[model samples]
Target: ILILFFVMMAQMVVLTLPRAAACLNRAQQVLEIEPSIVDGERTLDDGAREPQDEADAVAVFDHMSFRFDDADEDTLCDLSFACRRGQTTAIVGSTGSGKSTVAKLLLRFHDATKGSIRLNGVDLRELTQDEIRGRIAYVPQKAWLFSGTVASNLRFGNEGATEGDMLHALEVAQSTFVLDQPQGLDTPVAQGGTNFSGGQRQRLAIARALMKHADLYIFDDSFSALDFKTDAALRHALQGETRDAAVLIIAQRISTILHADQIVVLKDGEVVGLGTHGELMETCEVYRAIAESQMKGGE
Candidate 1:
């Protein structure tokens, strides 16, 4: 009877081995999968660390184009633009026009299939991901926050940030609601900032990004949640904070980017217009139509 019992136990163990092997193979395959973009080996020297010319372009897109591996057509086509320090560059377009892709390309989230993107005259492909992202502060369309105190979330941007720094950033972001909380900066935040309203979460996220010292500031539709008054005031205040850095605003509302130094109008992944509000109205029919449509809608 004991020998028969041991044989049954051994059989059960052997039966599980095939399933375990299959699970191990699946895990191994996931582990072996290569990252989409490889890190570059080049390092920046001390001289290359700082921009020699203040008037020089901070980012240059040289006829860049991109297409997903499964897509037949390019998402962005021969896009060329330059963002300079101390100036605002805005990209606006209808849905599926590839407005946000420009920001992703700059962040090196995806590599261009054709042409090149350069930062401070250096090709983006030649720099490591960290090196490229270190000089940029980006706020994505969706604002997110971890479960922690407001101060803790702000510190995620700059570990050494003082209370004063946090206050200034909050003030500039038009996030004074934090001050009304019982504990102010110590106010507890729920995961993903679910405790706060959409607009409040956006303001907090903006403040966090502001805490970082960056040469380029990218706001990807970050102002969508704010009221018109708040949006205008925040932009007004941002001028002071970003006076020394390049500002890139990706927006759908024409009012959000009407005063941008350069407005890039994209239609079907191509630049249909490239100029200021006044200039585009006169030159680019696509831009004029968009502006007119928005005005009619009272936006």
Candidate 2:
């Protein structure tokens, strides 16, 4: 019995030691790295000549380029585009084409290595991180939810939101599944929303973002999980809710961006085409090929 006990103890140590070492190495890496993005010292004044009207609140990327600290080449290369308020701009590209990097730049996750990003005529570098991010509501490709009641997760978007606001957001997101739950707004969610289906989690994430009132809305392939019917309904509702805000979407599916005011196509980290769906189909071979491929798949 003593020999068996000793063998079990030795096996346990052998199993745990490598995991512990790897965890320590990761913690050490995190401790050693400095944050690449930091808030600017200056704050925008109330009368700073920024766009006062919602229609004028525009986001512009001018000759922007970004390279990760460890990467040898730029992830985004001389990308230029404008997302204007009251219009939808969709970025579509193959994987590794840097579509999502554009959203990160706008969110100021990393400052551009070259050129400038401007909001309402002011350079992003001149504004505090909070000042820039406060005006944008972002929904990432993966939906993230904390362990709490449904109402609590929705409140993260706007703490001041009332039950009425929560209900309205759910309605707009077409997330009526919550209403059928016995707990309704109070339904408990597990960490990372493991309790919900992928489509349900996405709808909840969209509802949470809809609860906030912001100048810009960024949906980074947020609808990839939904069925075609739900996707269409949610987008229809979103148009009404975000009529005055600039909407930027990064999508892999051509169907998701067909109705966008402008579609920007990326290839190998460069802007290969920029135009409406019909315009791109006629003028850009890359866009035409993508559309044709998707059309065949759908058929």
Candidate 3:
């Protein structure tokens, strides 16, 4: 028995030492690396100027470029575009084409390496990160939900949101199934929303963002998990709910972005086309090829 115990102890030490060393190394790297994007001292509440008009709520990227640390080349180069208020702008691209990078820049996740990005005519770097994000509602590619009641999750957007507000958001997100639950809003959600399907979790996430009543909405491929019927219904409902706010959609599907006011096609981290879908089909080979591929796959 003593020999067996000793062998097991030795095996445990051998297995855990390398893992502990790797974990410590990673933690040390995280501690040593400082974030490039820092918050400005000024805040919107402290007499910061508000946007003057619908156009002012616009997000403008002027010759924007970014390169990740330790990377050899820029991830985005000379990108310029405008996302106007009361309209939808869709960024479509192949993988690694930097569609999500544009969204990250808008959110100030990383500062542009060259040129500038402005929101409501104010440079993003001039405003505190909180101040910049306060006016935007973002739904990430992965829908995350904490272990809590549905109402608790919804309240993350607006702490003062009422049950009626939550219900309205759910309706707009096309997630009326929540109302059928015995506990309704009080139903407990497992960690990471393990209790719900991918589409259900996405709908809940969208509803949470809707509760914010923000000036801008960024949907980072938020509808990818839903079926066609649900995606269409949600988009139609969103048109009514978000009629006044600027919307930016990073999408992989052509059908998802066909109705957008403008479509920006990206390839190899550069913009190859900028126009409406019909115009792109006629003018941009990249856009035409992507549309053709999707159409062929559908058939």
Candidate 4:
């Protein structure tokens, strides 16, 4: 009996050894990699401008362009736009048009290859990454939720948020479904929120972002999982909550951004059209074609 027990333990060790070694190797490889983005010497409080003249427009992208280190050419070219407080700026294009890359640039994932991106009249390069990210509330394309209670996840955005504040944010994000759960805010969330539907996860992620009072709010394809009615309602509620901040949305569906204050149309990593949806439909062949294609598909 003792021999058989020892043999079983040996078999288990042999089975686990390979996985343990592989995990260690991956960890070492990650530790060895040098970071491409480094912290700037300046903080947000150092040499910041008040934006007195352009108080409404908080973030300005000035002729910005980016090319990956191993890529053959630029991914985004000569992109210029302003995100104004109390207004929505939506970017739309076919896949690989670099709409998401714009968000990455703003998030400081990669430095721009050319031109400049400024926040509050200060260049992005001049600010520390932490400071830059602190001013922006971002909902990524993939709405990832940690394994915890719903209220705990929401508090990740604002550690000091009260229950009332969280409830308000959930309402703004159209995540009132949480209130229906057995434990409400205390409901357990499985890792990656696999327990919830895609739409529910997206709404919960939006609520998390809303908990933060940021100067800029970015939703990257966040409403794609929702139906039109819910999307419209969420946007309406969002407008009121974000009245004092700038909103940037990256979307593929035309209906999602149809009412944006400004619509930026991209093609082949370049800005092909910059105007409202109605204006783009009149003047931009690419925008008009895309709109027509989606409208026909819906029919």
Predicted candidate 1, C-alpha RMSD:
2.5
TM-score of 3: 0.87
Local lDDT at 67 for model 1:
98
Q: What is the clash tally of candidate 3?
A: 0
Q: Ten consecutive residues with minimal summed lDDT in candidate 2?
A: 46-55
Off by over 4 Å in 3: 1-33, 45-54, 296-299
Clashing pairs in 2: none
Model 1 TM-score is: 0.91
- How do the residues 1-299 of candidate 4 rate in per-residue lDDT, one tens digit apiece? 99999999999999999999999999999999999888778776776664676667878999999999999999999998999989999999999999899998899999999999988788889888999999999999999999999999999999999999999999999999999998999999999999999999999999999999999999999999999999999999998999999999999889899889999999999999999988998899899998998897422
lDDT score for candidate 3 against the true structure: 0.91
lDDT (C-alpha) at residue 249 in model 4: 98
Ranking by TM-score: 1, 4, 3, 2
Query: What TM-score against the true fold does each predicted structure earn?
Result: 0.91, 0.87, 0.87, 0.88
Order of candidate numbers by lDDT, starting with the best: 4, 1, 3, 2
In Å, residue 133's CA in model 2 sits off its true spot by: 2.0
Candidate 4 — what's its lDDT? 0.92
Which number leads on TM-score?
1
lDDT of 2 by residue, 71-121 (tens): 999999998888888899999989989988888888888889999888776
Q: Per-residue alpha-carbon lDDT of model 1 for 1-299, expressed as tens digits? A: 99999999999999999999999999999999999998887655534553455246889888999999999999999999999989999999999899999999999999999999988778888889998888899999999999999999999899999999999999999998999989999999999999999999999999999999888999999999999999999999999999998999999888999899999999999999999989999899888888888797423
Provide the clashing-pair count of each candidate structure: 0, 0, 0, 0
Off by over 4 Å in 1: 1-18, 49-55, 297-299
